[model samples]
Target: MTDHLNVVLHPLVQHKLTLMRKKDTSTGVFRQLLREISQLLAYEITVNLPMTSRTIETPMTEMEAPMLAGKKLALISILRAGNGLMDGVLELIPSARVGFVGLYRDEETLQPVQYYFKVPDSLKDRLVIAVDPMLATGNSSVAAIDLLKKAGATNIRFLCLLAAPEGVARMKEAHPDVPIVTAALDERLDEKGYIVPGLGDAGDRLFGTK
Candidate 1:
């Protein structure tokens, strides 16, 4: 893990990611693999969450146990593709507050244009995790984080299944404070701004679209 990036190479994560990258993988299988990999990534990103001790009765006696501190976590999913990752993380942190940011990239300009934005209240008080399946161009990811910071989120982390070197550099330059956790860091982006050796368009693969 670098200062701001954690590339998870866990066997399970790698295995599932390989399955996802296959062009012949069915939408149903791809979606399932994404969910499972997201769960594993979620575990890595939240390893050091603040904790507090709480008195609890185990079976016969009262004992102190470590428990999560602060308000419920905030999860911001960056539109259609992000929904796939969000579902799995939600399974682990079921009490986390959910939010969504919708952005689409302009083919000509290669810029992100926001179409929708909605997030939970008190973002400043909770740990926020932003989920997107791929970080290819990084325009939308950076733009989404910009909106999140404007909304008062201070402690934020970016989680994705695949990331390109270009996207990682873009994110590091744009928001050095936000740490990133991903399953694989691919070689580079293709001319069309898709990660080479990536699992294809995550949104389209998840939804069975062209």
Candidate 2:
């Protein structure tokens, strides 16, 4: 079985994440760091992608060269906060098909409310990757993945900058087949459902909303 949770402990990824976690990191700097770290995560997540060989001429010789086998990819951003994380991944995988799931959490119930959802066609043919910077309660992430599966995404992976134990447990219970890759796994979530030691709200930090 695939390891359900993967913490990218690469020194570079961890270093950048630390900088991102600081409270005073400027929006521009935070965004740049996220982009850099995101590219690294993108590299890690795609390491084992299926490959096929294609005939190609190198200088003066014809040879079979390896290339990705299936559809380029379907990158599903779990809206708002997810948008912050996707741009960096996009920079690395420019050919990937992009989609968005718009969900807002209701404070009282901490349930996800979907306002918008759209994804690429033939989702099952592509390796779908869902991006969300913070996996705090896992409610939004789980709901987003549920919707993606309903839309025909069979091969899916979850990517995030930080993950809480509660969120990781929630995802494992809900979608064990989908592996999760994150920069760090923090201790737990607070009463307000925020990840402890998390860099506040990812969307707010990314967009300067708060």
Candidate 3:
């Protein structure tokens, strides 16, 4: 993926991810960890956001204070696992707008088929961040980004909990302009298109299912 992927190696993030990866971690605990770690990832992803200054008076004097330069951000969740990450990001950026792109992978073909998509208007004026828990084959992530661009989102970033090498490569080839921020990039995708040594199905783990 060249230098497009940002693997957050913060100690706290890695620690929480380790616990989340364990097979015995309860669904409630896993969901909590994801929420917490997602906030940290959000911090990293927004680090270089464009900033400008605004004049403000502090009791005695007026001074220039830094403020976000662009329109309210658009947080697009690639459901249903993306919702887990989205909740945490929204905690930090409460004013950011939210949207959803529903897609399911064809197990046999390993391709993405979009079923639903709804996004905030004026995406071209905002910094659109797309969130999802796992980036496996990258089919769904790429497809989601495609839809976002078609809707007028020129600036976009991808946030994920875990990623496989194949998925990263796929995204790099398809959308080199979009940067990827992830907690950990795992080994590879297994035969079933699941990240090997991953935390298992993220949506199921987040919601607790077989």
lDDT tens readout by residue for model 3, 19-64: 9999999999999999999999999999999999999999999999
What are the lDDT scores of the predictions, listed in order? Answer: 0.96, 0.93, 0.96
What local lDDT does model 2 show for residue 61?
Answer: 100
Mind giving the per-residue lDDT tens digits that candidate 2 earns over 1-210?
A: 149989999999999999999999999999899889999999989999999999999999999999989788999999888988899999988999999999999999999999999899999899999999999999999999999999999999999999999999999999999999999999999999999888998988888887
TM-score of 3: 0.97
lDDT of 1 by residue, 49-154 (tens): 9999999998789999999999999999999899999999999999999999999989988899999999999999999999999999899999999999999999
Q: What 10-residue stretch in candidate 2 is worst by lDDT?
A: 1-10
Pairs of residues at least 3 apart in sequence or in different chains that clash in candidate 3? none
Q: Which stretches of candidate 2 lie over 4 Å from their true place?
A: none
Candidate 1 lDDT score at position 137: 87
Cα lDDT for residue 160, model 3?
98
In candidate 2, list every pair of residues with a backbone clash.
none
